[model samples]
Target: MNMTSYEEMFDEYVKSSAAYCASLFEATEYFFKANAALEATIVSTNTAKTSTIHSIQEYFETCKISLIKTIDLLRTFQEIHTTIPGEQVEVDFAQQYFYIKKTLSCVEQIIQLFSTVRDDKNLQQQIWDNDDFTTYFTTSADSISQAIIWQCNFAKRANLDESI
Candidate 1:
């Protein structure tokens, strides 16, 4: 394959991964909000909150699916890059590696938050209202955004095609 084709593939991978990451982040935020609302409802009402729980679960599932898709896209790009002749590819592998690691770290933070929410149903209020949790969430979101921006910039530079 030609250099242009590889560059095009890389551009697509970066854009697709960024989109998935954005989706994952948004879903997680919604999940937290839904769970917080459910907790408040539970505290105020004596009736079952099955529907609220189900809705929160759906948001959680979306996050998981988006994370998986993003990871798969990164891995596929890496695999393809490695298989291609070195002379035909101009991507900076080191930058790609670090970007992947940084993005994965952000994803791991979300997974940890998910586990915390899943394991302890009683601490929803504390988790949702805590300043530390807010900071943590914001930091993770910022990191993901920075990583995506860096990746897009790198892809543009590598491709030499400003259209991306």
Candidate 2:
């Protein structure tokens, strides 16, 4: 897809993910409040309150699993193609540069949104603050760097540095 379309998709994905997490948190807060009220009025029903908390925990776990899946889906942004008709396939540096920059911005935003939802300071202190963040940033940066090097070599070999 073109850069504009890719960006639109990325924004939509991030917004949807953030909204989902917000909804989950809101629901969790509501459940906790409800459980608290139950405990206040029905002090003898300890087992039921414990079960309510367990259910809330289970719900959050499921939401986290879903968030991870959507984050993994962001890998599609890096799968751009540069096909050639013959055997000699050259890199499209311009296309790579544009999309790589967009991907980097999207990843940064993703990291910000990812960190806001979680309370663990330890995880927030890590690189990108999410399980896939390190790999995503490193892989994208490496790909962009390689593309730059390859583009420079290609321009030098063709003696078309000015054109590039």
For all predictions, the C-alpha RMSD in Å is 6.8, 16.2
> What would the TM-score be for candidate 2 when compared with the true structure?
0.28
| TM-score quality measure for candidate 1 | 0.47
Please list the residue runs of candidate 1 whose C-alpha ends up more than 4 Å from where it truly belongs after superposition.
1-57, 86-128, 161-164
Over 1-44, each residue of candidate 1 has an lDDT whose tens digit, in order, gives: 88899788767656665665465456446545644655565565
lDDT of 2 by residue, 28-131 (tens): 34433433442342333334333333443343344334334333332332232222122223435456445334434534443454445433224324434465
Clashes of each: 0, 0
Local distance difference test, each candidate: 0.54, 0.41
TM-score of each: 0.47, 0.28
The top-ranked prediction according to TM-score is: 1
Please give the range of 10 consecutive residues that has the lowest summed lDDT in model 2. 77-86
Please state the error at residue 151 of candidate 1 in Å. Answer: 2.9
- Top model number, lDDT: 1
